[model samples]
Target: MKFAAFSGVFIAHSIQEAMKLTQKLGMDGIEIAAREPHLSPTTSAPRIKGIKALAADLGLEIPVLAGYMGGFSTASDQECEQAFDDFNRLLDMGGELGSSMIRVAPGGPNAFLAHDYHYAKAAHWLNKCAEAAQEYQIKLVLEIHNQSLVETVDSSLKLLHLIEHDHVGMIHDAGNMYITETDYGRDSIVNLGKHLFHVHVKDEIRVAEVGAPGTFLNLTHRGEEGFLQSRLGEGAADHQPMFDALKEVGYNGWITLECHAPYPAYERLAHDFQIVKKMLSWEHA
Candidate 1:
């Protein structure tokens, strides 16, 4: 399986630095975050070209561009059009960067309480985005993240069914799934089946208890009380079963590390890379 590092972790550094560090860490690719200090909707054409050339020069793949656009689940007609317009820009940027896929969010921050109609709205726009992405020969992978309508496997599958587009798929974000109390192992991978287009690995552990008020604290999800980021294998997340499930399903796609531990950037990435290498037995290879 191909391995990649999410550039969001390197937001403090320049895109060039992030790429170089990713190569040094023994990752095959770097998933660029389509945001500031790296890229954005207003990024100049010349800059995009420069970034692409540098990636090629460094011999690193731009597997996917993690986008920050969402709100399909709760937007007015005009707002929806604007969001789609922005997505079109992202697709253009992804094509220019030689990325095979673009990450899309299912809904806005409060999508956990989204109604059935809200899900339909997100699905409809995703279908449109999928059609547009096909022209660029790129796929749109929805993120199964907390606070989103597709946080659970069942919900994600339902949205995919609604979308019904060949180029549309989903990313199994195990960390976020853990926050939402979704199955993040064999059952989830098997149930997603052909719809699983990508994977994100990270670890989090509960740090506080929920009281009667039940107010969700920062970094906590609806299903969980409070949590903090932890290194791979050092956290409560059991990645072995998840990796075994991926192998069992023959999923040879990109497994992007989204490490967010408290350690220094390079140390955290390098350490997590070693852990993943051992899990996948790539160290021997």
Candidate 2:
């Protein structure tokens, strides 16, 4: 697997600077956030080509374009149609930027899947995205994150199976999956198996508990969402088995470092760049 950096790590930074940082750190590629200061569907086509030209000049690949839209499982048909149009624009941009994968969430905060928000909604929507991705000749990846309909492997598979498109897949996020009742990362990777298309490398350390052993707090019972920013291996999440499992599955895809801690964009991601390379056993080679 090759290393990549998520431009979200350098929030508010210019895409030119992000590209420079990625090149400086020797990351194989970058996955830019589909938002301001990075990119948006409405971003001018010339600017998109400029970004692509810069990546080529720096010898960095633009592999993924991550979108932040959500609420599919709960949004009304009108909302979904708007999102579909937004995704179409993104698909067009990804093709222009030479990105092979376009990342999106099934639904983020307030998904409320437990309250009659069925997988069918996500599946139907992703089927549409799959069609768009096919036209773009890129894969549609669902970022496994908390507060989304497909936060866990089971739920993720439920949606992927329903879509049943070759252009659709999942990107594993260990930090996001840690709080979903973790046994390290074993079960999480097991469920993903060969369905995994990309990996977001980060760590989480859970703190602040309410009940006793064998009992855990539900999402509502949790104190705050602070555990997600833990430093590499300093958090409750152990990623060894996760790496091992991916290797077992022969997952040779982009492994991007998402540094939220060890703060100040460059310093943190620079440190994490080494950490992730080691995890992939590239410490020396």
The most accurate candidate by TM-score is 1
Off by over 4 Å in 2: 108-117, 209-228, 283-285
Candidate 2 local lDDT, 170-230, one digit each (tens): 8888877776553437677777767788889776665565343222333622534334365
User: How do the residues 115-199 of candidate 1 rate in per-residue lDDT, one tens digit apiece?
Assistant: 7788788888888888888889999998888777788888888778888687888899888887777789889999999999999
Each candidate: RMSD: 3.3, 4.3
Candidate 1: list runs displaced more than 4 Å. 108-112, 209-224, 283-285
Clashes per prediction? 0, 2
TM-score of each: 0.93, 0.89
Error of 1 at 255 (Å): 0.9
Error of 2 at 183 (Å): 4.7
lDDT of each: 0.83, 0.77
